[model samples]
Target: MHDDLIPFNKPFFVGKELFNIAQAVLNGTIAGDGEFTRRCQAWLEQHLGTPKALLTHSCTAALEMSAILAGVGPGDEVIMPSFTFVSTANAFVLRGATPVFVDIRPDTLNIDERQVAEAITAKTKAIVAVHYAGQPCAMNALREIARNHGLMLIEDAAQAILSGDRGSSLGTLGDLGCLSFHETKNVISGEGGALLINNPELIERAEIIWQKGTNRKAFMRGETSKYTWVDIGSSFLPSELTAAFLYAQLEHAKRINSHRRTLYLKYFELLAPLAEQGHIKLPALAQDKPANAHLFYILCRDANERQALIAHLDSAGISAVFHYVPLHDSPAGFRYARAHGKLQVTTEIANTLLRLPMFSEMTTAEIRRVCGEIDVFFKITSKQPCELS
Candidate 1:
């Protein structure tokens, strides 16, 4: 199986990851808030058009920070999709706020905008819009809903660093946005994230929270004579080494994104037959927006077919996998949150979805191999004896 193995995801290198890490070390400030960290933050703020961007240890940390900034306390409720990473819900759950799980759109797999409006209650404090697979959620609809309901809009743009909707960047469309640089992302630094503060009023307090509840950022800027704890927070800043690697990757982001997009288009071309023949369903790109090629997945006819297809891929020395289970049915989710309505689409996608091998470094041959394996699976299954017929 190890021979000619194609992993579901392979980390891409832009040819400067290590050299920049070395430079960060030699600069003698490898901890945090060093030159590299500042540069990374500045680049994100300028690129994303956010008032403030603070690098964090992880997207989860950034979400936790947003929970704090949003003033989500006990009895307050936060609405989000049930088909997202746990960090999206856990961030607010940790603050004693209830996460109201909702269904996602079938095409974009993003939170349903109409459902969001219906799910809001008197106790609701915020709405966390998770841009599933880098396809942005309906931000205009969500923003209008938030404004009408007096709820804060937060963007969980973990997989949407270089993506945008309509004309605005994903991270700048909400009151607060979180970005991840995990190895699986378009641009990565192994395990890094950033908090995008769109609301200018939250910038000062965000810096305080990012600096471990202290005024260290202001102190470093000579605006404050002494730095001291002023709010509740944890050590969220990432090391300068992480920032250095991130900066290097960001420098070549255009090339990396372009390469990945080509692979995505190739997948679409290769798999169009399966889709047209009703053997599988492919993701539908947003018509008015742009994606960053974060992932490529297909939906089998049912859970059984999905499992069989995965087995076929595995036997062929390929790695394919399913995504998140519905959060409403999860143990932690049951204990920490409530379901808004029947998660029909969410549950269906969870069972039928299969993520194929996709990476910037992946070649056309690998994509063909994966697509061929799918064709082979259906061909074999078609010849199998029906148990009940």
Candidate 2:
């Protein structure tokens, strides 16, 4: 059983990922701001309808850039869900701002919008809403709150590309949006990300901060013969080699997305029975919202049950795993979160949730094999299954 250890997530690159890298090598422009970088940036802006898109080293970089763009600093507070990666909160925390961790929706695993208004106060400078598991967050409510309170909206769309509402994209719904192209993501370039600017006001500053506090972007446009340092910034850009690989993925975006969606639906359909039997809670899609099915996760009854399910899968040669340890529980966050509000759902769901094998190139047989193990676990445990399909 241990012979074939199906990983929880794997990067699937069938496009010109290697070909483009070779191209970048031949071009001798493997640094940032190369042709591939510009191409990927343009592709994101055009498809996602963003005014400007800046490619960064990772989603963390993009979020840090957002922190700079948002003017987050000491004494400021950023509201966000505790059920997320550290970068979601650390971006603002790095700027000396406090992260006002909130509870998540029990169903969707996204930030609970209702709790947000209650948490907003005089120090709340921004709201970082993460579209958890590629599902759109309560953007309408969050946007309204930001609008009425004059706060900035920064969307962590790392798991959500091409996942949005009726017409508007997920990242575009906020002032600034961050995306990841980590190997585990639906799209991969080994390690890369992008910062999408929705509000036009931040475009100039965004470029400045991205280029490490220089006016080099303007100089590139022939606007200035000499560019100099002007603001606080860092080298958040990635190499052109990375961008080149990303461009190849973007070229076959349609096909890659289609393959991932196929595998996603297969898992959903195959695991429907287990959901109905109350063994696990399936990931929920937002009403009328389109998601990339970027991940396939389920919530077991408890920590013990989740552990048992994972063990059972492991014994059967399937590799399933858990995601995000609640920041409130982690040592680093414990100090700052000591005085924060209670994280009731965050702590609970953090233990119960389990992520299954999900990748673009996964076969139907793989889904069935994984689901078979899940079904066996539920039957053996005799726990109430979640009513989901």
Candidate 3:
């Protein structure tokens, strides 16, 4: 990679990260669920207002834990959008459940709540609402639907830390919510995640599952005489080093998100003229749903245009990319998942969406350089200059 290249994502450190790791080492516990892990979990619980928060190695682990807590088994169907990361479907599919792919709203690129109701059947056991680009889905409507159908509502909040719908936090609104702290996210710990448990009934089991299927937590709390393997689980907890690194990031999360939102708005402001002229389409976030500004993206005229734009950016030493080949169209999806409807919107968005370079420490000048390249691309392709006013 060139030194001048503006990479798609960059991990940042606020303060006290290495110091905390050294402290964890001095405190003599670097294993999972140690001092640093407890601090990180407590911070998540307090900030998100969730009843319980358990740190995991990655968001994939969190999703897997939720799948088990939901009791989804073979022949049980889980509903989610196809325009999401594979972990959203793979978690349940690993437990022998079939993922039912659903369409997304054209505006937010989130799961279409209206389509969710139609997809429900006697075999449908859960609904996974992935908050795309840190934007909240129609949670009120989704919650009502989940209640009416007696199905579990799980939130794939991988990109939505500190985001909110109405007055409630995104991850706390559902029975189970998963968050990612991957390096690409607004707040990161290299690679880490957490599962938020809102339902009181699932708390005990979630703790057990987080501890590799033992009552070890209870034993530690002096609530039991001894710990033993009592249920099915895996080593989901992250080491104290990861937790210590994450706690430092969590301390400055609000400031980090604030800076990223500023960068997000800068991109929108610079590119709005092209959008107004129909050269591209800017993101449309709902008024009541404030996001964490996890990423900034644009919709090109078509897949061809998007590819060309990505190549143009790469040539200019900027890294722009696309993702998720519409899981329903992938091979594993063919075997473990099924589409619920036409999914016209999902397919369309998948073709045109392109994510630009975004990071918490990104500068306004960098954003301008990226948008300028976009403008140049359109000018070259369309044979005309777009009005920048």
Please, what are the lDDT tens digits per residue for candidate 2 over residues 79-107?
A: 98889998988898889998888888887
Error of 1 at 141 (Å): 0.8
Ranking by TM-score: 3, 1, 2
lDDT of 2: 0.87
Which segments of model 1 are wrong by more than 4 Å?
A: 288-290, 383-389
- State the C-alpha lDDT per candidate: 0.90, 0.87, 0.92
Each prediction's RMSD over C-alphas, in Å, is: 2.6, 1.9, 2.3
- Supply the TM-score for candidate 1: 0.97
Please write out the lDDT profile of model 1 over residues 1-389, one tens digit for every residue. 46899998888678788999999989988998899999999999888888889999999999999999999999999999999999999999999999999999888999999888888899999999999989989999999999998899999999997898777899899999999999989899899999999999999999999988998988989998997998887899999989999999998887888888888888899998878777888889777323888899998878898888898899999999999988899999889999998899999899889999888789989999999988888888873322210
lDDT of 2 at 117: 92
Winner of 1 and 2 under lDDT: 1
Per-prediction TM-score, please?
A: 0.97, 0.96, 0.97
Checking candidate 2 for backbone clashes, the offending pairs are 277-385, 278-384, 278-385, 278-386, 279-385, 279-386
Residue 279 Cα positional deviation in candidate 3, in Å, after optimal superposition: 0.5
Error of 1 at 218 (Å): 0.9
Give the Å shift of residue 33 in candidate 3: 0.5
Q: Clashing residue pairs, candidate 1?
A: none
